[model samples]
Target: MPTGVAIRDPREQLFNAAERVLLRDGPSALTSRAVTTEAGCAKGVLHRHFTDFDAFLAELVRDRIARLDATALLTSAGSGVVSHHLTVALTDLFGSVAVAIVSLVISRDELRARLRRTTPTGIPLLTEAAAMLGSYLAVERELGRIDAGCDLHVLATTLIGAAHMLFADRTGTPPDGTAVRRVVDSVIVGALSTPPR
Candidate 1:
């Protein structure tokens, strides 16, 4: 077997490798052999850890969602310009890696079913992202950065929906960080009233 990092967690290593493959080569290039090679592990290593490729993918998606959730929580807690923080969070989610995974899951029925089985109660990443943004907006509202009467859930969904479209666009060059920030800022400005002078 090939050797690589001395990390204790094989699953994490595999997940990281899989993510690299997805981002660098796109979803079609992702395979058990590719992941194991990227991780510098034996071909059977992935099977040893996960039931199969679909199960592994489901776990990977869940892990990424959990990471995004953590980021949202941290951003909400940090002291900074609310719009900047939100822009950063949404941009993170709209990266190539995320877009690739989301595209793969949507087009693959087996993987989608596996994911649904894995996460029964909670929403998928997109819905979860909207909820995270909504939670952050609620925090901003409490801090008087958002309008008191604004519908946070709707605002969050709208922002996420718009960002999703931009991220999922493949015909032209994807929006860069600055463009994403501008979109996020516009959403925030529209949702918030002017602060009392």
Candidate 2:
């Protein structure tokens, strides 16, 4: 690990280093200097790949999103057990991508200086995750496993919001399976009560 001279291609090495830096140091450590240092590259390498800080952050988010999406896929379509998925997917995202997202969103200065341009305009991650839930709900609703009227939209929104809040530690504690289950079940049952005919 020689400084100023990288071992592998700087691009791959930097991306790998970015993940390591993000995990060990969180989103706050994702500066060009920090990432290059971690990757054993000169500071200019970041600029060579990305146009600016915003571009780098954007790439970081993209990197994280891909990983989370893969995780959600693995969690996969199952029993539509909200508690199960919540325990696995949301919690996992919180620890990983969501940590960076939350950290960026929480800090006004950081959000403006580093995140505003890079971060998506709205809850893209949540929307994606919710859509995952919505897919499950669609199946459940079709099978009559859950309520038909559950407004998958609302359920998705609620789940994403609750998940974000929980991950941000806004509640002062990580949300538990029971709580997630209860809310999800309530929505399902409510949706079920509506006349499907």
Candidate 3:
């Protein structure tokens, strides 16, 4: 709001503001001005930190990707029910601004091109999400929980894709936990070395 007022962690502030705009107004409504206005900071603050709006958006997507935590998923490989762990992880992922961020990336050509320099292949948020699941699946395979011959890459991608669709478009509320668990269990059933729980 003020040109000279101190704002600590502008990048995080801007990122949060952008997420709000993206979630509330959708990708078409997002702009440097929109983000700055949402953040209550000067529009020049965005330019000072990023070469352009696309650059800022690229970092936002990357930052979201970095925040996808796989620790619980990885550690649950041998102990917890595989399908249950997967359900929780996928549900948590889609419950965030991820669906909106994915939509934002798809709507912006320049942003996508800029992201490609670092990502090189696949959509940024979705690809990283697939990788997170893949890593957990790999751990399960190592522990003999998942079938030896199952292609984890495909499984992981399928899970992310299916889960994304489930959470992508909705009116009032996210899909119920039972709905999410059904999707996770359906995708993971054939891959489990043991019978599905």
Q: Which candidate is the best by lDDT?
A: 3
| Model 2: lDDT of residue 117 | 48
Sorting all predicted structures by lDDT, with the top scorer first, yields 3, 1, 2
Angstrom error at residue 106, model 3:
0.5
Residue runs of model 3 more than 4 Å from their true location after superposition: 1-3
Off by over 4 Å in 2: 1-9, 19-29, 70-82, 105-121, 170-189, 192-197
lDDT of 3: 0.91
Each candidate's TM vs. the true structure?
0.80, 0.69, 0.96
* lDDT of candidate 3 over 155-194, digit per residue (tens): 9999999999999893457898899999988998899999
The CA lDDT of each predicted structure is: 0.78, 0.60, 0.91
Candidate 1 residue runs with Cα over 4 Å from true position: 1-7, 69-80, 118-123, 169-174, 195-197
TM-score, ranked from best to worst: 3, 1, 2
lDDT of 2 at 100: 53
Q: For model 1, how does the per-residue alpha-carbon lDDT over 1-197 read when each residue is reduced to its tens digit?
A: 84644558999999999988887777888999999999988877889889999899899888987877545555564366776777778887776467777877876778888778655543368777888888888887887778889999889988888888888864458788778777877777866655221
**What's the CA error at residue 28 for candidate 1, in Å?**
1.8
lDDT of 2 by residue, 1-197 (tens): 65544455666687778777766676666778888889877778889888876676666655555555544533444454444554565566665546555564454353344544444455535555677666766665676655655688787667677666655653256667566555545444456544221
Better of 1 and 2 by lDDT: 1
